[model samples]
Target: MSLIGKEIGEFKVQSFVNNEFKEVTKEGVLGKWAVFFFYPADFTFVCPTELEDLADKYEDFKKIGCEIYSVSCDTHFVHKAWHDVSKTIKKIQYPMLADPTGTLARDFDVMIEENGLAERGSFIINPEGKIVAYEVIAGNVGRNADELFRRVQASQFVAEHGDEVCPAKWKPGAETLKPSLNLVGLL
Candidate 1:
């Protein structure tokens, strides 16, 4: 079953952040937007670039009351080591969650059992812990943080303004369409 619209905030997850272990559950995400990004592992190509990109845009996400969490199958110690050694990873202020047991990855349905790693998956969960948007990409392709920011903006916009919906390639301040039977043939 697709996890779309499913509430996943109840699941308690143990992850490492800033050299300390912590549990992240519904309470952690309460009253704020959460972005959970699952990647393969640490000390690999593509993942660092993607993470660095997100780090570069961290302020933008923070401004919107969103917290970013990057997850992988590696242990939290590994995450911290990578953060210490890799120049790119050092800039990431967001939490790097360790899913060594693959529980969180499996819950997100992005675990690759054969390799015991996570696939490229991104989930945007609202304050209520309901998943609002999700993206799963092939292992070879890295994601764009700018696009993710735009999606967050659009999602927030629609949440505040119930009558409008973002259209394809929607950007902030762009016109959104109001779904209606009368507009069925208009497109």
Candidate 2:
């Protein structure tokens, strides 16, 4: 089933951020835009590259009132350990959510049962805790943070405008299409 417009269930997990362990919960995630970025595992190839890319754009996401949470089935301790050892992971300022129990992985429908890991999934959630946009791809493929950032911008724009839709390669301040009966024939 599609997770779009579906409200997220209650969850509370330990997160590694700012050289410390913190608690993140559904209540904390509510009332703001959030991105739940699920990866296969920590201390692996491709994952760090993607995470480092996001780290570079973390401030941009925050400027637009969105928070990014990178999740893996690994424990919070593992997250911290990796952060300490890897320069790429050390650059990350966003929260690294530990889903060791697979609660979050299952909730996001990205869990790999046999492997006890998550697939590559990116979810954009609105202030109301409902998913607005999501993409789940093969584990071997890496995602683009810039594209994800653009998507978040598009999602926010559509949410506020309601009547207008973003066109291909749409950016903020670019023209948006307002659906109407007059345009039905064009499609």
Candidate maximizing lDDT? 2
**Model 2 Cα shift for residue 49 (angstroms):** 0.5
What lDDT score is found at residue 26 in candidate 1?
A: 65
| TM-scores of the candidates in the order shown | 0.91, 0.96
lDDT of 1: 0.88
Q: In candidate 1, which residue pairs get closer than 3 Å at backbone N, Cα or C atoms, i.e. clash?
A: none
For candidate 2, give the lDDT of residue 61: 100
TM-score of 2: 0.96
Candidate 2 residue-wise lDDT, 34-114, digit = tens: 999999999999999999999999999999999999999999999999999998999999999999999999998999999
Residue-level lDDT of model 1, residues 87-113, one tens digit each, is 999898888887898888888889999
lDDT at 136, model 2: 98
